[model samples]
Target chain A: MLVIEDLQVELAGKTLLKDIDLEIRPGETHILFGPNGSGKTSLLMTIMGYPQYIVKKGKITFKGVDITHAPINERAALGIGMSYQRPPTINGLKTRQMVDICAKTKVDTEGMARSLNFGDFLDRDVNAGFSGGEIKRSELLQLKAQDPDLMLFDEPESGVDIENMALIGTTIAQILQKNPPRAEKGKPFVQQQKERTKMGLIITHTGYILDYVPADKGQVLYGGVIACAGNPREIFQCIGQMGYEECVKCTI
Target chain B: MYDLEDLKEKARQALDKKASFGGDLDLNTFDRSFVPHKYLAEEEICAIPQEEQKRLIMSGLDVTGHGRGGTYFQKDTSVIHCQSKEEGIQVIPVTEALKNHDWVKDYFWKLVPVDQDKYTASALLELHDGYVIRALPGSKSVYPIQACLYLDKENLQQNVHNLIIAEEGSELHIITGCATSPHVKRGVHVGISEFFVKKGAKLSFTMIHNWAEEMDVRPRSVARVEEGGIFINNYICMKPVRSIQMYPTTYLVGDNATAMFYSIIVGTPGSYLDIGGRIYLKNRGSRAEIIQRSISNGAHIINRGHLIGEAPEIKAHLECKGLLLKGGIIDSIPQLEGHVEGVDMSHEAAVGKVAQEEINYLMSRGLSEDQATSTIVRGFLSIDIKGLPEALKAEIDRAIDTSNKDSM
Candidate 1:
């Protein structure tokens, strides 16, 4: 579980996010709604400890440990994973190669494909020239390999085509359902569930994200504050109608 | 006690003082009759004309003493010596190997002519390529053969011809070099080398050249690759020289032949280094690759690599990248041309400074800003050392490591 208490972020000499508060727990998905440059992506990147997003104030505690300034790899080691909106393409590095790297295991490549629906192009360079849908699947595959304690999704629905949305949504559910529980050395059944790896913060912008991902709570972040909280469908309909700009105006 | 310039002056004077060490002092047969392009595509259908076979004789001499408007002469091999029993494992002067052993002299340069031009042949005859090395079948020498040449005098014209032959299934590593050591006047240093590879043979040639201040060093070399041969050429230019224009060519004449060339040119304040490799797929089903990376700071480095697929069923790839910093300049020109359709050829080039995003990503992984940048730079260079010989891999890594440390 991770908790963000009034997080304030500033970058490139500009105050981006001002006093934002949120929390994510195991087995729960939280969709953060905001428009471009409204600090939506910055908040996700900030939680993942991107060095460029300088946290000017507030505190971020992961599993009761204050980690507002932890290094990226350190955070990674602590099971904090993120799916970038525009993932970086690792040239000359193949997709399966990255899977092997992050998995740190000889993952069942065939099974992984069946799960993510990308069995045809595992040998190609990592995201070198992937389609929109393919890129989204790669992110999901990386998350499965990493199995982070806290998962942050930034616009996962951007590339999900209508034909594959249901499959992708189901694949994610399967991953969450088939969780190996928290890994504990030399422990069986009960220890496995204790390993209960977590997936928490789920951010989406287009107002159409949770049509696939059933989240614990859907909150609106407008003008750098929690503008509203309600059912996923209700919030989707509001943003679907007025957009985040009107949401901010209504917050006033 | 010998500064690079001082050494160059001495080498020039020693040559003028007369060839003290007698190695190969005969045969300056020149080929006045140029082999026209018509003759080029026309292989020896029947023992190439007597005139053509006569031109193929393994000798370093051209008539009238000049080759292709360039000066030509044999080298003085006295600089070479057996430091210990290890260097003598299978090492022999190229010319000596040719005269005493008929098979070596007859078959070595038979493919690649030292006298591809008039002066080269003339120079081959004069002093001969100074030294000849014969790594017998299955002979793996531990110590590198050191071929040192000095540009002794200023304004003096010198042409040094050399030959190396790696016999069947043999492994020979050569650390051939030339520098403007102290005593050598500010002048020109032109050194040429030609090598032959027999079946199943492997050779690692490391060439490191540091020219004296204000001196122009020009080196030209060629290697003839045979069936199942592996030739690795790693060239490093650490210091700035006036004008360095070199194009080392590898002819893959047999099937299943593999050749890889990795070169790094570090040009400093005021230097111009134009270096690259040419791989000519002369036979079917051959494979070759050339990777050239140059790092320049306040200098100019030009890397031009070309893969010429002369025959079908060949695979050739060329990748060139230039990393420039501190107002330095770099020009990368990579070309892959296939005459035949069955060949797979691709050439790409990228010119850049260290990517900021890559640096940041690496830094976020517990590396300092400097550490991150160097790691990315090293990754850019750690490309070809994967399948190289252990010694070569180590040397390449060391060079890159040193460069990384220095940049930091």
Candidate 2:
């Protein structure tokens, strides 16, 4: 479970996100939808504590603990994992080794890689020479390896083909099933980890992932604010009836 | 400078005598064994070369004996050359270490042989003070015996011969560093170092060379690894030594033997460095690995490294990467060739500028653009900083950090 209160991100002296508030409950998949440059990826990076994007005037809480200023590795160790839109290639660092390090001995690599179809990249450098799909699979393998309680997915379904789309969908669903959210009463979302397996906040411009797994909430972020929130299916239907451009025009 | 008359007179005086002690050497002990002989300097000539004795000098390598083109340096000159002394490493000049430590002395001759050229042979053969170094069976030491050679005017042609012997099961680390006094005159330097590692021996050698910016340097060195022995050589070049050309060769002659070479040749504007390493697997079960990294700016660097596995179970590897900053040119040649089966040999080479994404990402994280660029550049150079000893690795890390901060 995670909470963001009036979160704002500024980069290159420009406000990328502003006045954004979100509460992710344990065991629920929150789909963050937006058009290009809608601050979706920027929000994910802010949550993960990437140094570049200034927090400006926001607070991010992971499991009720303010992690607005945590470093990337610290966030990772705290059971927060983010699969980026574009993975970094760190030469000489083996992918398997990184998974092991991320897992912190929580999970095994062979099993994670096997489940994610990355047998060939076990010994290869981390994200080096990896195809788009391979990078996604590697991230999934790491996600499973780390077995974090909170997962942030940035365009996880962007580069996946229809064939692997099914695989991706299946794996995502399985992971969702593997870590159901906590539903305890009278406990803050911060301590919800004791009862829940895992929770996730996924960002995507295209609603293609709806073809695979059900999303609990579909929210469109414009001007760094939630313009609308509803069933992912209806939200997608709205986009279908009214193109993203028209929706943006109407919102502005 | 007095040349042929003086050298010939010395050679005639020495060679005319008979050898009552052909190979009687004092092992593990220093004794006076200065065999006065002609220090040859030829335009183009051939003579069966022998091991050299280099004297260690800590200061004064410039002021070559005075006046234009002189052959002699003052006795107290800060210049340090090989010396034959009753004290010092195993005494009696390194050239004769073979007789005292015959089994190990065989490797003393070609540390980096003085060539027929201007500096290679002259700086080595003509220098009067030199030392003979030998490591006996199972012998290991802590500190690196320091050796220095200095030159100035016309061309400081000094002959330096160094020998390192790791007898069976012996372990040793030797340091050969060259430096010049501030604002010293420029000259040419040709030096040779040869080492031999016997069965089960381990030798770690380091060469830190910082010559005058206007000097030309030629260094040729080699080592032979015997069965179960390990030899690791590291070279660090930091000064803007104008032109540098060196080829370090190693022969893995024993089964299950290992050799590693780590070299960093940094050349600034108006500088050129042709530096590399070679490993010849002449026997079964031998292995060698060569890794070279070069950073050049407004200069040219040519690096060539190769690995050879001669027989079965022999393993070898080579990795060379060059980083070119504006106006820098790099031509790298890495090769892995051998007939030995089951030999794991690979050579990877890459050339590129700083990664833009990494820079942008770091800069976004509160780091300045310069800080971002340097952080990534240091990261590139710190690739091997990971598996080193904690203290040494920390030192390396500190250096990178300092460089990064300075750039910032």
Candidate 3:
């Protein structure tokens, strides 16, 4: 489980987010919806322990451990990982090698890359010249290799073309354990649900990923706070019918 | 043929003249006296002292000669071992070549001027032993020929002149390492090398330097490529040295000829390294590229590159990148000149520390801060050299790996 209470984040000496509270139990994926500059990404970055996102007064607990001040690598080691929207290019480090680093052991990088249609990019420098969809796939490929217990996806479908949307969405779904285990076919639904231990928090703008990933809950961030919380599909319908102004009214 | 007396006089005139760049070293402070070692057979080379062999191996000279096409081992002023295992390849000491081979006179001082600088003059005046590795016409080397210039005498100035030639339609790969014995605290090395790539021929020469902290090195080298030929020159220096300054130049003299120069430099504290490359495109369709990567760990380094395009339809590029890990100075100078309207030349130079964002990106992949920095540094040093043999590429990677360990 992951929990954030009374979160007030400041960046570069400016308050970006404040008075935020959230929780995500195991076997659940939450969709984050908000207008631009509503501090959605800031909330996720604060949760990941970026250090630059100073938590003025808050507590972040992950898997029952207080991790409000943990470093990025420690957070990663404790089964928390994030797929960046615009990761920096690391020259001379092959994607193949990056996968191995994420795995922390010898892995079938080629096999994993093939599954994501990224086998051709295994030898290239990490995100050196990747296209939008390619970068998304590369990030997802790493996340799959990491196999973190709590996964964070920051706009996974932003720059993807229609051709790759399904691929990226399905891969994200599989990583979140939303897809049923193929080997456990014909198993009881309750048993399958009991075995789904991975938790996910995805930030989206278009909500196109909902076609593939069946997010259980959703929240609207308005004025640096969670304005409302409800079923992800119902929230999407309500936000589509009425602009984010409705959320602002609800917050007021 | 050139007059030997005239060359000697030119060298004498420049003997006391200071180089245009780099720190000046007084020649009178070091010994140039001849130091001789007995010729070592193949088996004897393998049976040498283990400690000394370890030093040589770090510089990429394997005493076992397992996969080498030839071996040339010069210790101090003596040619201790010289042999060629493959057919149509000649590994001869420069002195012996001058004494016996009449054709050697044609190439002795042909490419590099004897009066270029004080270091070149030193190599010409007090000449020690160097190698002349040549590939015959239409011949191809099965494995890279290995050469070593080992300095064992303390405070001695080891002067050497080397010539490498690839005849028409032939291919050659050479790996040469220069190192000092473990006990030598201080020394000076002045080396002159000239290369020739004949028509339709290819030559790749990789030089690795491993020297002690008190060593000062100066190497003068020049190359000429003919029509339809290719030349690849690589230089790697990772260990600490008091001072090293060298700027090798290549000329594309014939149509469609290509030349590429790649170098990696690492400077530790108390080290001063000034290194670069220059390529001149003189004919139509000639192409040239000079790429350099340097890191300074509290040492002062100067990286320079110059590309000149003189003819129509010529293309050239120069890139110099420097990373400052510890407190040190990195001066990157890249120059490009296009004299003709149809010539195309470009240059890019950057000097800075590793991007924190890049480090953070790696850290997010679960690596610690130290691991992230070293990974980026190693990647920054790794360059994909075109046409390099797999074995030679592996050798370069191994050198970078060992140095990465030391630097971290």
The candidate that wins on lDDT is: 3
Q: What share of the true interface contacts does each candidate keep?
A: 0.08, 0.02, 0.84
Shift in Å, residue B62, candidate 1? 37
Query: lDDT tens string, model 1, B15-66?
Result: 3231211112221222112111221111222243454222211111122211
> lDDT per residue, candidate 3, A26-128, as tens digits?
9999999998999998888888889899999989999999999998899899999999899998889999899999997777899999999999999999999
Per-residue lDDT tens digits of candidate 3, residues B1-408?
768899999999998888878999998999999997999998999999999998888888999998899999999999999999989999999999999998999899899999988888889989998999999999999899999999999999999999999999999999999999998989999989999999999999999999999999999999999999999999999999999999899999999999999999999999999997899999999999898999999999999899999999998988899999997999998988889899988888999999988877788889999999999999999999999889999988998899789877
What TM-score does candidate 3 get on C-alpha atoms?
Answer: 0.98
| B1-408: candidate 2 lDDT, tens digit per residue | 324354444434543232221112111122112223343332111121211111112121112211111121211122223332212224235434434555443344434333323333343335434444555676554434334444433334444555666678866655455655444455555466677888998877656665667766666577888898889887767566677777788988888888888876666787778787899887777777787777777678888887877787777778888877666898898988877567777778998777766554333233445655664565555556322334334433444344344323
TM-score for each predicted model, relative to the true structure: 0.61, 0.58, 0.98
> By summed lDDT, which 10 consecutive residues of candidate 1 chain B come out lowest?
B65-74
Show where candidate 3 strays beyond 4 Å: A180-186, A248-252
lDDT, candidates in the order shown: 0.63, 0.63, 0.92
lDDT of 3 at B188: 97
TM-score, chain A only, candidate 1, equals 0.86
Candidate 3 — which pairs collide?
none
Q: In model 1, what lDDT does residue B359 have?
A: 57
Model 2, runs deviating above 4 Å? A1-30, A33-83, A91-201, A204-217, A220-252, B1-105, B110-119, B128-131, B142-155, B339-343, B385-390, B394-408
Which 10 consecutive positions of candidate 3 chain A have the poorest summed lDDT?
Answer: A243-252
